[model samples]
Target: MSRARRLTASTTAYILIPILAAVSPLLVLPAITANHGASAWASVAIGQSIGTALATVVELGWGLNGPQRVARTSEKASLRWLTLSLQTKVIALIPASAVAAVAAAFLAPSDSLTSSLVACAMTASALTATWFFLGKGTPWLILATDGLPRLVCLALSAIFLVMGAPLMTYPVLGLLLPSALAPCLALYIAAKRAPLGTKLWWRARAVISALKLQSTALFARAASAVYIALPITLVSIASPSSVAAFAAGERLMRMGLAAVAVVPNAMQAWVGAPADRQSKWSRAKRAMAANAALGFISATIFGLAAPWAVTWVFSGVVTLDPISVWLFALAIFTICTSRGTGGIGLVALTRVRAIAVSAAAGACVGIPAILLGSAWGGVPGAVAGEILAELTVLSVQVVAIRRRLAAS
Candidate 1:
């Protein structure tokens, strides 16, 4: 297939995975709010929030570093690498699952065991052929194995919501079903097609070493998760109403970010291709510019429509103020412009520490911002902090990329 076709297909699949997956929350959350009220909706949202954070820990940099490994590896080594990576994630999965169970115990009192299991499943979903597919430049495969199951589960969630199933059932169908299905399907596909030679125990040892190598990339990935997941956790602590309002706005913003993520998803594959340094640098610069343009357009359109969208999506159960909605738009634009181009470029270039440091700096600015903002102005303040945090990360990513280019 042509490079352009692959990029477009991959980007579309990548975009669809999240958007389709989001249908669960978009449909279920509001349904719960309309049926049971904000407290019930908050219960599901809290479970999901905690689950998402644990899921990030389970991924352990595979999503970011796995693509780079795939990009640089020979075809013969690809399956072996995939197996090895899967082993490493599985090892991490054990402890992470334990942690999730404990977290669910404290955080999700309504249905702790089920919620924890859901969280563990979502976290384990990261251990699949996704990175291998992205690395092999067959990102469309991700749509089939990863995206399809979630879409199927989304339909189930919608049906359950319409039937007025119990509140916990919404999360069970929405979060647990998809999280369990997607990764299992991806791993099955990989195992049927390509078996690695590494023994289980040996693979475990090698995974330790691999973890050391990928530590910086892992750090970067974890830091990125903070801004995305932390606010939900924080808002839950603040108030049930705040959780509903913030989650409503945050989910919409995430959908927009997913749309523009096609740029970076393509950039990673494009930049990872074997090429001269100068040419790669040129492509990176162009990709960044293109991403920025897309971000601007996405931000403008989404910002304009957000007020109406928020009302409709939440069924008028919860409505964010204008400032919160616009700040969400700004956050969407910031992520769209920076994440796909600048952020992925750093990973492709193996500037893992640079990316990690930059993301850490943003978190340092963001966590406090979120706490203070939520305390002061609730949803709007939290979003204001989000805007500043993303902008901070973006600024650092640009400077780091520039310095890396000049030095090279």
Candidate 2:
């Protein structure tokens, strides 16, 4: 197949996976939010927030570098690499999930068990085959192994919730099961397909070497996730009621982030392919432009429709302040753009270290803003912090892109 045609097909297929299957969690949320009390709802959000952030830590930044690494290797080599990545992530997961559970329990003391379970489940998603499939240019693996499980579980979770199942059922069926299962399934496939020798995947030397090499990406992706995810957790520290109001908006924004990821993700293989400097820059320009248009649309729709969406989804149990919603919407726009500039742009050019520096710069600005803002002005203030962080990452990336051009 021609390169352009292949990319177009791959992009369309990737986009469809999210549209058809991966959006299930969003569809199930109304049932969860309407049935649960506001505190329980907020507590669940806290777990997801902390869990997602720690999951990134467990992933060890492999998602940032794995696709490109695999794109350049043989199928057997790629499988072996995935095994190495998984072992390191497993080591990280032990510590990360523990921290998430502790923080989730402290924040949601009223609903500690469910909250901690949610946190642990989301953390376990570090094992997903997302990066491996993307590198192989096979979006179907995502649907078959990862998306389908999450979709089925989400449906079951919704039904169980409507029938008055305990709150823990959602996290278990909807999150924990799928999150851990996908990687196990991936590893099983790897074991069957790859001519992997008898070397132990759990060896300390291999895990430590992988960790050292990927440390920059680990720190970078983790730092960036802080601004994107942890705001609700931070808000919970101030007022549980405020968290409900903020959680709806945050959930909407997060779901939007998930939906829009197909763009940069689909483009990753294309951008990260071996190319001349100028051609690489051109690919990134097209990616950033496409993401900008999508970001604008996402922001406009989110800002205009969020008030009603939250009202209906929460069954009027949670009402949002407009200022907070719009700010979060703006953060959504910046984040989408940054995903192009930073997620694809920096990583594609083999500028992984630059991404780490930008992420650190963003976290330095974002975390404190969230910490102080949530305590001071509530959700709106916290969202403003996220916006600042996203913009900082974008600015640093644009500068890097420009420098790449000049040097070329």
Candidate 3:
């Protein structure tokens, strides 16, 4: 294929794969609740949340270290580090799966018979990690490793649901099975393309020394967590129901934002490739302005349609009041604008510390607002808190980006 066609295919695959993979799981929630009851469903959600949290920590660790390794070593050496990390993670997944199986058998309701299901879920997580590693070296590997699982899971879940299986079983089958298989499949493809070769291990002493020298990168990773993950965590704790509500709003918002992000994502890469600071600043401003316009237009649409959308999507499961709906719609707008600007600025300038600072500020504002809102206003309070936090974070990002551009 021509380079342009190849890039187009890759982008299309990335966009479509996740949507297909996510659809079955998203639609299956009502069935799961009908079969397992709310409390049981809550348990499963909590378990998944915990698993996701652990995975996030590991990802942060890897991100903090991975780029530093790339900076310190040749491209070939960096590829080796990535390959080794993928292998170690894949090997570790087996034991993790076993442990999750045992825990599900004991912790999940015995009547649910979730051990096999949980095992599959854990395996899938491991597979995803492997696929991600494969994608790092060969970007096209992303289509095979990343996109295939979604296709597989969508198929499996459809089959299971058609057979009148318990709703609880679908989560395990959908999440775990694909996750487990995607990596194995990717590895198989990878092996055929290029066999694994041994490389000298960077000793722990050297690795640790390298990490210490790149402390700013480490801090950036932590800041990223605060920026991206904190809102979801806070929502889960403050108003569990609101988490789902917010998630729905955010999902739709993200789809809209993705359309806006294409230009900015491309511009950042172009800017980063050159040493021309003036060109980078000009591109950044244009991206920010474009994002702002997109946000306003999208937010207006969301505000108008949120009530009907939420009611239809969550029909007979969760009901939303007007205030809750409004808050969620507002959040969708603020988060997209803030995150887009911040992401573009950070990438263009390579200002890791600024990214961290803005993210930290956002987390600081958002978490407390969630806590206080829940305590005082119930669901509405929770929604209000999220809006406040997001706005604060966005403000910080705007100021930081401006200062960075000025300095540049």
How do all models score by TM-score? 0.89, 0.93, 0.72
Worst 10 residues of 1 by lDDT: 194-203
- Which lDDT values do the candidates have, in the order given? 0.71, 0.82, 0.54
| Best prediction by TM-score | 2
Instruction: Please count the clashing residue pairs in each candidate, in the order shown.
Output: 1, 0, 4
> For model 2, what is the alpha-carbon lDDT of residue 232?
83
Candidate 2 lDDT, 266-294, residue by residue in tens: 87777767657667768878998999988
Better of 1 and 3 by TM-score: 1
Q: What are the per-residue Cα lDDT tens digits for candidate 1 across 1-408? A: 898886687667777755665554565555766776655555555656666776676677777767757776765467667666767777777887777667765765365655565566556666656667877777777787766766666567667767877655655666567666655676566555554552223455777788787687778878877777767777666543477788778877876676566667666767677656666666667777888888888888888988898787777877878787778878877887777544567765667788788779888998888878887888998888888888988889888877887887
Ranking by TM-score: 2, 1, 3
What digit string (tens of lDDT, one per residue) describes model 3 on residues 154-224?
56764676567765556666676666566566545544444356343545565555445446653554454
Task: State the TM-score for model 3.
Answer: 0.72
lDDT of 1: 0.71
lDDT, ranked from best to worst: 2, 1, 3
Error of 3 at 33 (Å): 3.6
Q: How well does candidate 1 score on lDDT at residue 33?
A: 65
Model 3 error, position 312 (Å): 3.8
